[model samples]
Structure formats: C-alpha cells, structure tokens
Target: MSYAEHFSLKNIPYGIASTQDRPAAVATRLHDLIFFLSDLNLDSPATLNALASIDKDELVKLRRTLQTALGDEKNVSRFGIPVGEATMHLPIEVKGFTDFSCSTEHLLNAGEAVLGVRSFPPASLHLPIGYTGRSSSIVVSGTPITRPYGQYRDGEEIGFGPSRAVDYELEMGAIIGKPSTFGDRVSVNDADEHIFGVVIVNDWSARDIQGFEMQPLGPMNGKSFGTSISPWVVTLEALEPFATEPPAKKTPVKAYLQDNKIKSSYSITLNAEVLSEGSATEVCKAQLQWMYWTFRSLVAQQTINGCNVNTGDILGTGTVSGVGDDEHGCLLEMTKGGKVEWELSTGKKRRYLEDGDGVRLTAYAGDGVGFGECTGVISAAKPF
Candidate 1:
C-alpha cells in the first residue's frame, strides 16, 4: 500500500537509517520504505540537531516537498530503501534529559500501592515535578539493558548485587527544537515553537536501588543507568490533528504557567507488553491525556528560572498511567512495589523484570498515526 492509503502523508516522521552499503543518514519513513533526505538535494544536514535549528516554515516546506515526491514513482525508486533492510540508530544527539512526574493517577496509584495512602504532594499541583537524568545513557530502542548492580536493603542487610527490581516506565519525550538564552523565560504560549517533536520513551528503572538510595536526595545511580527512545520522531505538526484539551485542573496554576491559547495534550493511547520465552503478553494500556501537566507547562517550568534549553534536549512525561491497576505504567506500581507478582505469558510470575525478558511500548492516535515501537530486553548484569 502507498503512504496515502496506509497513513496520512502528513505523518512523515524523521529518523536515522543505515544499510550494508550506506552509512547512517537522516531519513524519513513512508509505508515500508525509508528515504534519505540528503538524496533529495534539499540542503539536508547530517544530524537532527541542524534540521531542528532551522525555521519552522522551512521544516514544513521540506516535509511538503517530501510528500510531493512520494507521489512520483521515479522518486520512490531512486531514493527509497526497504525499511527491513536498514538498521535504525538514535535519531538525536541528546545533550540533556529531564523526566517529569506528570500523571495524577500515577501518583495516586503509587501512594496507595507503596505507602497505603492515596494523595500527592502539594507542590505537584502547582508545577511539574521532575529530575535531571543522565543523558549519556539514553539509547535507541532495541538496545539490551544489562541489569545494573547496586545496593539494596533486604531485612536489615544492605547488600550489593544485580538489581532484582528492574522495571520500565512508559513515557512520551518532547524534543527541543529551538534554543533559549540563559536569562530568557519561555512562557507556555511559546513552548510549541521550541519543541520539535515527540518520541516514545522507556525510562528503565531499578526499583530496589532507587528505594535504597532515594532518601533526602532523589534518584541517582538507580535512574542514571539506561533509557530507551523510539527511533522515529513524530513532529508536532503531524500530531496537531489529534491535539485535545488537557484535563481541567482543580487548583489553578500561576499566570506564567497557564495555557490560554492552545490545546496542550494529544489523544494518543499507549500500550506496554512483555516478551518472555518467545511469548508476548500485554501488561498495561495507558492514555497520554491522563497527564496533569502539558508539554508547554514543562517547557515553561524548565525555563522560568532562566535555565537555558537547547536543540535536542528532551523532556519526558514520566510513566503515563491511567485510572485502573491494569493501566499502571510500570512493574513497581503494577506489582505493588514487589508485594504482588504479575503472571507472564510463559506461566512465570514476576514482581519485576527477569533477565531475557523483553518489553515493548507502542503508541498511536486515530487510524494508527503513531510513534513507532520503543522496545528493550533485559540482559544479565556483568561481573563486578
């Protein structure tokens, strides 16, 4: 099927692809074929950073030209390669990654699951709560995550070993397209122009390590290990058709954080599944609209203090969980902090991920306009 019949040509997303004869190049997907933008003689750069730095109108024009080219058989045959024959690489050279706890349902579920309560911190209602993560460890999807070795307390015995409570967090990552000066404040109204696109993110977690290390300080070694993102970047323009109003907040935010002009959330649905011993079982289903804060809100909060943000910087919506237990986004919340065991496809029970278990997260809007799969498998930890 052609791109038009299968999906909206407007859904053209960008990525990095390589073949046996070709080195890695910036590419775009149409149906099952990948086309290198550099082949189009459009002054395409080698990396997404340069593309992101261009004017928004220029980006739109490039996309439109590509769409027009797709209609020509000669253009398809000249520059397109079967996607299966190519290897996908990390799409962006990330400089920084910030993850925010933006789902109220996720917070409430976590409080009830871990602490026998159902409430959130007061500060969360006012602004997005987030943490700066190690961007160096962010890998493209399909990269195997080695279970990290770290310290954990087991019945008063603090021991160090490969983490027993490894988990996956389903999230959506916003890619920064524009730069901000160190002293400039970006209001919520301007956040859209600064963001280039969205990608599926799997912010892998080591729950036992996090529990042992997170006391006065927040997540450190537990979270710094690995994060996975889907190869394709679905630009914001492609998602505008699916944009919807964010849930109305009961508590009002400050004037600077308010969004009065634009719909900030998308009606995207996400699903997480585990592949064990060749069998795959669906684990969770979530909605991106469940988040309490919007992407605009996060961008404004990050810059309100005069913190500069540059192209390729990422902001992640942490664990996009919904209202039900089955909709919980991670093993820590799904298994009730290891107190309960979830049954997998192989008839095995797990409170957390086991070595060789693969996890896949997928997301989409109406008629399968989607962010491609974000997947990772667990491997045994290396010797100390």
Candidate 2:
C-alpha cells in the first residue's frame, strides 16, 4: 500500500482507561469521530444526558466486544470509534500500562557502563533477557513522577532513603491482547497474531537504588515504584506500513531467538525532551529501526519457559540507543554514566534527573501510524 493511502487521520488507536469526565471508558478514534464503548449503549440515562458519558457498564461491554473482535479482520471495524464525540474528560484520564526491557543493545550498553565491559553473561544473550515489572504504577503523560525511596548502600554503608540519582529511560512498549498458557512457545511468524497494539513507555529508574540492589538477581525496588506510558495504544495493524527489517545482529541468536526471515522494525522517529522548572528543551531524536532486536523475538523468548502471559502484560523495547553520541537513550548514557555533562539549550546541564524536572518521549511511525507522546514530570522525593 502507498504511504499516503496507508495512514489516514481516521485510524486512531484504541485503549481501555478512565478519564476525569467518565471514570470508566473505552475510547477509539476514526479521524474526528470519537466513539466510546459507552456511546454504543444508548439505553443508559447518563448516555441520553450526554452522548459521551462513559459508565462502568459501557466499559465492561466494550472490553468483552473487543476481546472477541481481535484476530478477525471482518470484526476489526467493530472496535473503531469516532474521535470528535469522545468525552471531554478523556484528556484527564490516568493511564495504566506496563513496560518490559527486551532490547539487547540497551542491556549491553547499560552492562558496559556498570560492569566495565561490553555484552552480558552468555545466558542473557542466549535467552530472551527480561524481568516482570509493576503494571499498577503505570501513569499517563503529564503525570508527576515522584523520586522513589528505597534501599541504598555505597561501599560499607547501607541505608534506606530516597533516590539520589533519578533517571529516565526512552522506550517503546507493546500491549498484549490475547493470552497464552504456560509451556506454549509462540513462533515469530505468529508473534504479531498475539499482539494487540503499541504504545510509548517510560520505564523510570532510580539509578541510586538500581546501583545498590542489581546484583545476583535483576531489578526489584529499582523498577517497581512507578513506570509511565501513553494513553493511546496504536494497533499493530496500523503500523504495518512502517515495518522494516530489524537490525542485523553482531552474533547469531539462539534457536528460540532466531527468525525465519528478517522483519521490519517500524521506521519510526523517536525524540526526548527535558523540562526543568519553568523551562522545556528537546534532548535527543532517534529512530525505532535502530533496535538490535525485534519485539517478536522478545515475545517468543518470554513464552519459551512455558510461562503464561496475560492480556494486559506489557513489554518494553528497552532504551533504543544507537552508535552515535546523540542517539543515547538515557541521561546515564548521554552523560557517559554520569562522568560527563548533558548540556541543554537552556544553558543548563544535567548528570541525572533533578527535582521538578520533566521528561517527555515521543514517536511517529511513517505518516499515518503515529504513537503520539508519553511524558512524565519529576517530583522531589517526599521529605523523610
């Protein structure tokens, strides 16, 4: 399909969430047509009072309807809703979406910084490296991210306190629609079949907390506190036009990570911006195609262990960094593990996130399938 013909304004993403106006709502967009699952229920008195007011019953019904609509091309349109008529309270909704760390490049870079070496243990490379993160901590864009308090120790001293070095990770996230049981291995060819949609994910980090606890096992307090994602979930079907081959690997992957054929990595452009108190500035711009691994590989490896994945489970394509200096994904890398300073346009410099700092991440795939933006502003740790 031609680029112009593929992406049209009508193709807004779908997501299940609550807004200030309608606490429980299922929203979909087709150009200016905003349809809430609630709108389908014309029988509610609230529906008659305001065509856009989404109630609990409407959301539950929509969820049931969409669950059945997935995987059937004929029923796909049944999930779409107009954007113009969407409720006014929609913008104020609190977003809840989980993220995963599935990128090989991101893992390697982070390891090199802390471990003083490149690459990871052979087991990590051979297997799909991942960890389960908190989904309840997921918040919508523009929400304030509080610096978390956790266990910290430097050298001989260990204590419980607030994070001293807060940080941000630029990542892309995928939303699962259908679920599979334990012991079921999914193939790359069928990976997309199980996927529901995509969203921008910000896996916030407490560098100080991570630095202290990440040994033997992976992240615990370093990750669980809070993670943020965009409110909109652009469907995989919409992103087909932008698909491109995943990055060439430096080494062969294990049998489980291998793909029958090369697949597209979605030619999307990603950017990050920093906003200090009273000021906002763009930090970096990179491409989604730069990923060293594919989302399909991540999903495939996840289920190889026979572990079952649920519908709301999220996977983050770790910080998507490239070879160039400007392409680095987090303040840790951009500043070379805090050894250098990241100079911003406002003439400010940062080694790590500070109190009252806001970080914004955005991505756009081709012309039509844009994932919009996901942002999180930092708040100082609560006084001890």
Candidate 3:
C-alpha cells in the first residue's frame, strides 16, 4: 500500500492535504512527505488555483525552488509532514469538465458491443468528439461512488431504479492552468501554455442507463453522478521525458488543430484493478500513446467555438483502451454489453460493479514517477 515511490524527488506533484492539527491547504509531495506551501509565500493568494494561473516561467521557478527545498534536511524538518498522517483532498476547484472520446480502439470496441460493429462514425476521424460533464460530481481518490438510479429499458418495458450496470472508464484528465477569454480560440501550438498537469480520471458510468438514454443526445444522469480523480496533479514539466509522438492522423485536421511541430502525447502506462474480498485483481492494462487525438488538440477543439476555459477546468481523455481483451478500459466493452461475465481473482463473477466493488486506476511513466491511485468504492443506491 506504500505509494511513496510515486512521489519521488523527480516528481513534485501538487495537491491539498489536511492533518489533525492543520486545515486543508495547498501542498506538494516528495517521497512520503507532504509539504504545505502556505508558508513558502509562492503568491499573495496561497491556493493551487492561484499558483496554477501564474506565468509558466514563474511556475517553473517555483518548481525548481521546491525541488531544492525538499533536498535540504533542515527544510524537510521544518515543513514536511508524513503523508500517512494527512488526508488528501481534491487538488483543484473544478468548475467545468469536458470528456473527449479520443481512443479509436475503445470507440471501435464499444461500437462492436453496442451496435454489433467494430467501426467508428466518420465524424470521429475529423473531430475530437466530446460532451460537457458535471463538474460538481468530481471527487478526489478514496471517495465512495454511490450507485445511481435512473431509467432504463427492461425487456420491452421501461424500468426505473438503481442501475445494474455501473462501470468505470479509465482516462487521464488534463488540468487547465490558464484562463481564456470569451470569443478567443486556443491554437494547438499554444495549448501547453494553458495546461498545468495531468491526473488519473475514473469516469464512473452506468452502462444500462447510458445505453438506453444515449440516442439523439449524449450521456446525462448515467455519467453525471460521479467522477473520481487522483489527488496529485503531476506537473506537465515532470512528464517532459515521457513525451512521444501520437499515431498519425488518417485524415488531415483543420488548420487550427495542427500540431505537427509538437510531440503532444506521453508514453504513460495505465492500469485498472478491481479490489474485492480483500484482493486486488488487475483487469486492464493500456497505453496512453494509443490515443488518436493529441491532448493539445482537445484544447484547440474546446476553444475553437469560443468557449472560455478557466483554471481548474478538466479535459478528460476518454477510455484509453488499447487492442485485445486484456486492454479494454471498462467492463461494458470487456463483457460485450453484459453477454459475458468478468471473473476476478477473488473468484467473483460480475458483468458490472456490485454495491461493494472497488475500482482503482494507476498511471505512470516509470518507477517512482506516477499519478498515485485514483480509487473509489461503490455504495448501495438510495431507494427511488
């Protein structure tokens, strides 16, 4: 259970934590120590949002200063708190969330399950298809996800009650550090300037409700219930070493979405585990490099229609699935829309999550460099 390696000196990811004697405040991690920055005087308004909104160069300077501070034993003694004694909180005050379907493999797999075809709509190749999501439901890791109630088709009759097909979508969330004004567009080349960091996102879903309602429009109640994210926000600079080129586009993109000059994808490995009956079983392993659309392009697409973005906003790279059964991101696809049962190492068979199932997501470039676990346990639904 020790995640100290994820917070090595090489990665000073930012977050917020609270201890018995301290109020929730901005903090950063180095190894197993959590250092609150309120005393560092990084800005007049000492919050992660303020720190994120600062100029990129100034933020870089702050990173270097913290790295240097964490190296000194005297400084560690003065400010560092054992992470075991602290409770992690949501790292950002997210006001908006947009999740994009960027993985071609996931799209095709989902299509095959839901529509009996392993093909994507032509529009998916031309644009980064996405939908606005409920930001208020976003929570930090370890939070419990309540099983949601919604309407669905039960044989020939419409049914209403707790969803029977609760699922999880493994994704990476891009945190917007800088704000953009209304009526202004962000070009792909300048997208990095606006992004602060990345975190693991578990886009909790209700497959039965989603399948019944997602026609003519997109997900609503099925998706808006809850979204769990890692507490640590791994800075973009820390991931520079992992940058890699994304797959080539089969069709050219619009001029505003062009990013031939930038290597916009990272070579991060993603994994999901089902924790049940005191055991953790690895259900899926995927690669972020398989995403067809670059993270930068998501920013470009978000702002292309003059939609303003603000600090703490989230852009989700939806369901980062690769090829094969073991690489599927969600149970809905892996189970072929409930036709097959997924058996965990604990010997429990499930087509979707049961009331007490736990889902944990982890992403990293290498040892000692990772976004710590994004975890959530399912709770029984309230009666309708």
Compared with the true structure, all predictions reach lDDT values of 0.88, 0.65, 0.90
The count of backbone overlaps in candidate 3 is: 0
| Global Cα lDDT for candidate 3 | 0.90
The residue pairs in collision within model 1 are none
Model 3 worst lDDT window (10 residues): 38-47
Compute each candidate's TM-score over C-alphas: 0.97, 0.80, 0.97
Clashes of 1: 0
Scored by Cα lDDT, where does model 1 land?
0.88
Error of 1 at 201 (Å): 0.4
Candidate 3 lDDT by residue in tens digits, 1-384: 667888887888999889999998889998888988875554434578888898889888888988887888888888889889999999999979999999999899999988899888778999999999999999999999999999999999999999999999999989999999999999999999999999999999999899899896989888999999999999988988889999999888778877965678999999999988888988899999899997888999999999999999999999999887899999988999889997889787888899999999999887578887999999999875
Q: What is the descending lDDT order?
A: 3, 1, 2
lDDT tens per residue, model 2, 272-379: 888876677766677878776677776787677776656656767878777777777887777666677776667888888888888988888866567656778888
Per-residue lDDT, model 3, residue 108, is 94
Candidate 3: pairs in clash: none
The TM-score leader among the candidates is 3
Q: For model 1, how big is the CA root-mean-square deviation?
A: 1.9
Q: In angstroms, how far off is 208's CA in candidate 2?
A: 1.0
